[model samples]
Target: MEKEHRAYKSHCLVLPYPSQGHINPLFQFSKLLDHKQIKVTLVTTRFTSKTMHRGSSGIELEAISDGYDEGGIDQAESIQAYIESFWKVGPETLAELLEKLSSSGCPVNCIVYDSVMPWALDVAKKFGIVGAAFFTQSCVVDSIYYHVNKGLLNLPLTDSEISLPGMPPLEPLDLPSFVYDFGSYPAFFEVVIGQFSTVDKADWVFCNTFYELEEQVVDWMAKFWPLRTIGPTIPSKYLDNQLDDDKDYGVDLFRSNNDACMKWLNEHPKNSVAYISFGSFAQLGLEEMEELAWGLRRSKSKFLWVVRESETAKVPKGFIEETAEKGLVVSWCCQLEVLAHEAVGCFITHCGWNSTLESLCLGVPLVAMPQWTDQSTNAKYIRDVWKIGVKAQPDEKGIVRREEVEHCISEIMEGERGKEIQKNAMKWKDLARKAVIQGGSSDKNIDEFIATLVKR
Candidate 1:
């Protein structure tokens, strides 16, 4: 049912970069604000609004054009072209949205824009309202980008190791792929680095991480920006359950097979199945997929894997049917529900921030198979700092061979080391819950954000 419209002390327009990973956190944060009686309007591109599966969360939804009203990035000539077009068109549409809202007696008081699109803050400023930059990545990752943006970290890094403020020394392999490989996905590298362009001007900077989880980097960032940590932005049901109706993230770019996945998990024993997924965007080459498939077979452990429909053809012929008695493979499944299931032993993941946070929040150990971008860094933390998982090492060909994949899975799903990792995972899970529950670190930061909006 649609929620009743009611008067609120402040109206905040939440804009996320148009992607499943980017949209989910911002939407979850919007739900929290709505629960606090802050009027929240979530804005998506016309294309995304048309394609997304909208849940009945009832936060007001609005749409602005990203220039391709029919199809978003897929319609563009290139990533660079798409980004340039969106940059030019996004601000104009956003200003129009502001003008429309103002004339309707519901003027926006703030715009919490995805940091990737710094132009949104410019629109917020043009309308004379508070602008908050919301970063959907970890603080350590953001700090790396901020340094690169400021020229503190030089590209084509000459050193084997990097030492930065409030972060542990990192090997070149441990840095984000954009930084380590430089010029790979140039457009996306620009987007990540460009986030700092107008960030100093934003009234507040919010990161989707709890303070306790990233205390050092968060503290370092706070010194330079009005930074606040308010996340692990999954549904409240997975965290604190403070928002009664908060279950799934209210939007998804793809449909999931919840019933089939849950049924498969129900048939497995506790902590017996390895849950494998490469997230929405990462695509494994056919050879890698074959290796992963064979590795699952060789591990002899029951497993559940999510292979996006586009990538399903790459799966080895007859692999699914051959492994049918021991495994289930689907295009997509409700991730949180699968992670929360007692049968899911360890996650073999791409280590995307959203997936990492989900596994961490749900107390699932990991076998990190990092593909690119921030996944490597997250995997580093998963193995080193967090001690809740093991990172799979790839060979010189840059493929995690079946042997290594099988080894990592075994390491996490069996033996004394697995027990320690499971213990650490549960400890972080409790901390995650505490951070989002009443009077906790993330909850307090959110309260401060709302309080500031009301005062403004």
Candidate 2:
């Protein structure tokens, strides 16, 4: 009887939209479930499994076909083509994987799927299992998308300011790029808005944010959906240190020069280095890159910048050699480790949701240089709502000038405003830690999820 019970333990399969940012939070959440003695399997596409720099996540990994076994999204003709193919093929393979797991004696009882791929929940329903929608963005951003999906917020801004429940008035620019710059990337816009298509049917709606961070929005959304805030879903060491060996996200799609970056940071003075990265997918134009390069040079602050290998040429000619004494430019470094270092005083970022949350959780002030998508909205919060950073304003040409970049960096690093921003950053950091530690808001929510799953 004991053996049979152990063999039939409740299991959850976590499915993330195939990207580093999407995978990391879901994987961290899977680790949380695994730590609670729940059997967890992380689902990746066959292509991503082949491409990623696999790390020791200490959990089982399984692959499903995204209809592009050979090359994934890059092989697809366009974003729409890729999404359509995945939607058609994902359900069939997912059902097959479920059957395979069931015959293997570890039947999956639940699926925690990326909200963007809502069809996964339909598969879970077909299998008579619980389906949890895992949203990998801020509640405010999700709420905005939800509103747009429900036709509450019409497109092509005619209004000077927009009002939404549980959020302050937002300007046209403060809205997500998908909404503000309507039709810019219609396929991606569809993917974002389509998240709400079947979300009402999910057994649980999980947002990767803590209650303290977005209490008002979370509460408002909870009234309509079974919304739960269970995140900052970063590794435990940086926040509460509750989970053993939870230092890094444990999986990377890109390589990092860990030793070199750490060594350079170690040599810098405490709270002196400005750590700059634009996450993995953002691409800046050559002119913008040139301006940014010179801007960092003008700031006269010691900096460490992650310029992806593809963008290396865009860095102004001789800029690397000229700034070598004060700045270290590398392809990539372990961002969490760099942010946690005492030498990293401020972050100059593209304001991607994951990067924004990481900076907020780690107590690092920011200079928000938003690129696109949900970034503009996040940057708005970072500068106005959170009071932890200042946004670098772009000119009418939608290019942030070198002088503006220097000013934003200076404001965070040396100006009187820097002191206030630093204080707010530390305050959010403590709150973030408290949310994930034992008996805290996010911890309790995770416990509730596990308890409900076990009961089912």
Candidate 3:
């Protein structure tokens, strides 16, 4: 670490994918650094960042953007155009920002990037400071994809019937059609294949998970990369449990409709309401949406769903009204608060890593419906390894089945086995809390990871 006499103020830029799940971790990560007394600039597309506050109070944000704020693109066409433009124009924006910062007295010395945004590695190289790419998924799952793409899989299976030995086989019935088919994740797979190369370009690869959640996978990643796992970095947990009455320390880094969601969750019983959401970006078809809607209705349990405007993927209308009184479906919900609510019993999620960790931290069980990408791997951990949830099935092309959805929902919420999973959920939840508590594993890991970035 840099000594005070020769040391300079540490400057870092946090770049996240313009999606909700991607932004949540990025925000939490920046907060964790701030807690450690490091200077950070958290950047997001101006459009997405607007959601941070419904009505502005004029409070300063980490840092603002300039020259083509990424907020204008909406819908598939706009998104595609923006991405193409991003690929062609993104790096220069980063470089220009760094140049501006350096011109000011406080020059940026390092960058912490979302692993998917390899452009960050280039930014770090440009400034000649260490960069760490945050991998938001379990390393184990990423390794499987990396190995599979590199011809590591000689499985008799040809299609997406992905079954790792000793791990549960998550058929298309349980995963998104794209992942079951493998070819569907063209962009994600390309990113996965290119992930290792980024490690060489980075100072290290950081994950928002701990050793307990993924012992083997982290070990594997560490062999080839300077992998650092430190997390469950929610700010609320740092405060005393009795401080629920306290005001939020700062704005939520991501935009989620908190007021309505919190009221709905507050009404449910301790360990009773089933929390459901498919983090952002996994588009769902009508049949799939209906299957989920019907299955949740059949489960005869209360639920809070975070469904974005694009959620239905053009599904029918009556479903939401059909269960309006018994269900709460919002465009977005404050996930950490919902999970922490004593009323939330189990989580019906797409098994995105961020969602997975939140459920684990709350110690709630899962109804795993991994839409695409590493979701299958995350689902495996929830069902097979963690033993905290059941995997819902998907159809031939990778949509979830109603029966599978119904069965898993019933099993997780009311079945005899559900009771057992809930019990384990509580146990794991405690461990998660311990991991983040002072002197805990996560705490130590963060210290170590920061040590790597600390200038000497």
Best by lDDT: 1
Instruction: State the local distance difference test value for candidate 2.
Output: 0.92
TM-score of every model? 0.99, 0.98, 0.83
- Model 1, span 258-370: residue lDDT tens: 99999889999999999999999999988999999999999968999999999999999999999999999999988999999999999999999999999999999999999
Model 2 Cα shift for residue 363 (angstroms): 0.6
| Model 2, C-alpha of 244: deviation from truth (Å) | 0.8
Candidate 3: global Cα-lDDT? Answer: 0.68
Write model 3 residue lDDT over 23-116, tens digit each, in one string. 6676677666655656677776666566555222121244334234644456335444555566556677778777777875557777888887
Q: How close is candidate 2 to the true structure, as a TM-score?
A: 0.98
Q: What's the CA RMSD for each of the models?
A: 1.0, 2.0, 4.8
The parts of candidate 3 lying over 4 Å away from their true place are: 1-9, 46-81, 148-180, 238-257, 312-317, 320-325, 395-404
TM-score of 1: 0.99
Q: Which ten residues in a row have the lowest lDDT in candidate 3?
A: 54-63
lDDT over C-alpha atoms for residue 388 of model 2: 95
